[model samples]
Target: MFWEALGSAVLGLALAWAAVRRLPHRLPARAMVLPTGAAGALFGAFLTHSALGSAGLPVILVGALAVSAASLSLLLRPAEGLRRRSATA
Candidate 1:
C-alpha cells in the first residue's frame, strides 16, 4: 500500500508537471501544483481500492491517474477564469 501510494504520487507529479508545461498561460506555482497532484492521486487510489473491494493494482493505478488529472484540471480551471477576468478588467 505504501509503495502504491508513492507510485501514484510520482505519477501524479509527472502528469501535473506535463500539464503545467502545456498550459498556454501561466496558472499556479509549482509548489501548489505538486502537492495538489500528489494528494489527488493518493486519494484517488485509496478511493478506488476501497470502493472496488478487490481490484487489480493496474486498475487502481489507472483509476488514480485519471482521477488525479481530472481533479487537477478542475482545481486549476478557476485560475483561468480569474486570469481572464483580470485581463478584461
Candidate 2:
C-alpha cells in the first residue's frame, strides 16, 4: 500500500512536470503548474481507488498516471487559447 501510494505520487509529479514543460509560452506561469499537477494527482488517486479497488498496483498506477496526464492536458489546452486571447486584447 505504501509503495502503491508512492508510485502514484511519482507518476503524478512526472506527469505534472511534463505538462509544465509542454505549456505554451503565453501560459507559462509558475502559478499554473503546481495546482494543475496537484489536481491531476488527487484526481488520479481517487480514480484509481474507485476503479481498481486497491489491488493490482501496477494497473492502478498506470491508469492513474495516464488519466492524470490526459486530464492535465485537456484542462490546460483551453487555458492556452484563453491566455493568448487575453494577451492580444
Candidate No. with top lDDT:
1
Supply candidate 1's per-residue lDDT for 55. Answer: 81
> Candidate 2: deviation at residue 57, Å?
1.5
Candidate 1: residue pairs that collide: none
- For residues 1-89, write the lDDT of model 2, one tens digit per residue: 66766777778777777667776553446566656665676667668778778758887777777777776666554554464545557
How many backbone collisions does model 1 have?
Answer: 0
Over 1-89, each residue of candidate 1 has an lDDT whose tens digit, in order, gives 77678888888898888877876265477778777888889888998889885587787888789888887887554444564545557
Q: Rate the local accuracy (lDDT) of all candidates.
A: 0.79, 0.68
Runs of candidate 1 with Cα error greater than 4 angstroms are: 24-26, 77-89
Count of backbone clashes for each model?
0, 0
Worst 10 residues of 2 by lDDT: 76-85
Candidate 2 TM-score versus the reference: 0.63
